[model samples]
Target: MRGAAMSLSAAASGFVVFLLSVSVVQGQDDWGVTYTSTEICALKGSTVDISCTYRYPSRINDHITQVKEKFWFTRVSNNDYVDIRSDPEYSGRVQYIFGNNDCTLRITDLRESDSAEYKLRFITNQHNGKYTGSPGVTLSVTGMVTDLQVQVSRLLVYKSYNRAELKCHSSCRLPDHLHYVWYKNRQKMWRGTSSYSVSVYPADSYSCAVEGYEKFPSPPVYAPRVPSVSVSPSGEIVEGSSVTLTCSSDANPAANYTWYKENEVSPKASGQIFTITDFRPEHSGNYYCEAQNRRGRHNSTLHLIVVAGKFLHSATHILYQKS
Candidate 1:
């Protein structure tokens, strides 16, 4: 149901060179099955449908060769096949669409493991009458995160803003005219092309998705947000007491925290949490933490004032800004 409208595109865009596979007809046109498409390429988390039609003689040997049962399968051993609907891996996600002489297999919430050769089989009421479609359809479920990516090319970088071009790239070759949907901060933007260009800020994140399969968007590419710092002991700092300073920032690919004191040429620490075992006047300077990633960096400064033994103020003051 996720891609009810995209079923045709999903089924058609298997590959540039299409191959037709069908169940070979028996002698004298007694029985046969014809598949709609031999291959399908669909998004990892979307739904797909594989359809086929079959034919068989109405009467044989003075007895009717009526169809008894029909199902789809992906595996076989010693001439035994298990229906995909009964498989635990496909529980509640597999369905069969049926019409006169036509049957379609619908699988929702598809996974990478679902990529396999799928075949349609039917059993007739006649003795030893069983037919399985030959050369089953091959399904390829591609993951959006790895298969699709946003390529960033910076055009200009200034102190206030940045201008860049973002391109939606796919490892698998897709159709040239496939529509693309751009997203900023997880919201849809007014652009629908393979490439997008816009002005971006340090806090903005961007992603893209194929039209109709918006649920499986590519991983967001973003710079670090403004960092924030907090003191573990939220009380009056006493002399010789341990105090921990923690910094955090929201970012894609995660941000690394580095602690530094004001006017220091080198970093004081290399983690999110920095602890001062003995709180004293020397540690009362302006301390700050820098959160950095591949995209950009930000910092938060904390002013710590330590009196001789007790407090001038109970709470610490934190200042956050872009760096």
Candidate 2:
């Protein structure tokens, strides 16, 4: 009976060893690395995180030991690789999140130069136990721009006054923590929110910009407003006299001025001021000044009459004949 009991115990121990060997073989066959995302897109001046998980056999050739080192790299040359954390370009911007079987790389203040392929490598204490994940994540960094939209209230406040609403937007949904800024005629008018409301006025010009990037504001937009015309002489225009017409308007980026005559398809002059030296009778016509910008355009008209020298003399002779 004692011999039989010892034999049974030895057979059970052998069975357990056989099962352990099979388990080790299965784990080794499944050793590999996988990334959460093969490709990732990030905005310039923003932050991004790349994640990965790795697995390895617990025992290789009956050798079991702790992992010696792990790191991330972009290139491998001549059997040598440089860790991204040690690279000068990523000195302050890169951070590593490491775990027993998982790792993550975080990059902040991203720039176009940060775009690259990133791979993770690990080495174990066992001799010649090093593995690198091939075809790693690809990172793409792009610039962010502000977009501005204008909306008008359908209902008027006082039966004739409508309010204009300006909203700031971006291509990618930005964090709600970020604040917005509003500008009119290059002067800051509002801040703290993405939307701003104001009394509608044709003469007002407006634009939107982000808080950190005030210098690069969105293109200005303005509702068309009638241009104001002023003559240099400030009186009746006479023939053979030099005359100058100045056009002014309240427009974002300032309005471009163009002078046109009635029945003419083409503009007679282009600029804020139009000058006609030695004015002639043919110059007498209905003139209009057009103020335009990227937002819209407006026109204001003025009738310019030039009296010939001969007409004044004829009028004086008629008065003498009547006397």
Candidate 3:
């Protein structure tokens, strides 16, 4: 109800704010306030304007009702309304603009705590000419840094590609009609709905941001890239010698690695590094590392050969490398 005085009350439970509207009685219009809007949703570190017009009778008990003071307050402390401008938390951030029968409250550098019901209250020269606009305006501020996130969901992974769902998410409720911008490798891809579906590749990175705040995009999310396998000694796996195999991959959520030898039903080892203290011919085979995450997995193979037995006992060296 634009400019209509309505009795209002609010109750906050958890993260949700609820506003209740009630009918105003007749004769309350003689001195009442009308707001341009009753609800506002803004992003953190942004600015907002809550404007309203007020009314008062010309005379009370035959005395002129001269306006003495007008201000905005969200609550009453010690049975007195505290002016928003005087609040230390809002100091240097609140500006009041008064025009012909209208008053606008301008707030800058908004914070999540600024989410509250703001009301317009005024005092007149007359003894009983004080009025407060009930159920004023509700301001809900979302975040610019912490809350915005890109949530990744793995739909399906087949062969060399993975089907994924990406959602632009926030801690507080934002307007449902907000246009979202998607980024692939930090480059703008398209502007569309908040949720997007795309085929994922191992080397691609994805992020999301609101349309107007592209610079503050959510952290990039990507699948594990093809892993690279390496050996510590890098030369040869000699009999009764120790050797270590390491697998590494780049992924948003770090990938977990498993070591397996060809023809083995179960995994040989679990971790980024797999070590064999006593090298033997039985360990000579095609050993592959599987780097896996929620997104998908990739394998890198390393062929190992042990230089043992009397035939090559004095050979001292055997070449082993990753395949």
Which one wins on TM-score?
A: 3
Give the residue spans of candidate 2 off by over 4 A: 1-48, 54-68, 108-112, 123-167, 172-175, 184-187, 195-206, 220-323
lDDT by residue (82-144, candidate 2, tens digit) is: 898888888888888887687778777777798899888888887877877777777876564
Which digits, one per residue and each the tens of the lDDT, describe model 3 over residues 1-323? 33432222221211222222342321276877877767776667666667777888998788877899999999899998999988998988888888755788877777889999999999988887788888788898866634577777546767677788888886544545568899999999989988999887776788888777777788887766777787766655456777888889887668888888888899989999999887777767787888777666767787766554411211112122111
Show where candidate 1 strays beyond 4 Å.
Answer: 1-74, 80-114, 117-139, 142-156, 165-177, 185-197, 218-221, 310-320
Error of 2 at 135 (Å): 4.7
Q: lDDT, candidate 3, residue 230?
A: 78
The estimated TM-scores of all candidates read 0.54, 0.43, 0.55
lDDT of 1 at 210: 78
Cα miss at 86, model 2 (Å)?
2.5
1 or 2, which is superior by TM-score?
Answer: 1
lDDT of each: 0.75, 0.64, 0.72
Candidate 1 residue 81 C-alpha distance from true site, Å = 9.8
Pick out the ten consecutive residues of candidate 2 with the lowest summed lDDT.
314-323
Backbone clash pairs for candidate 2 read none
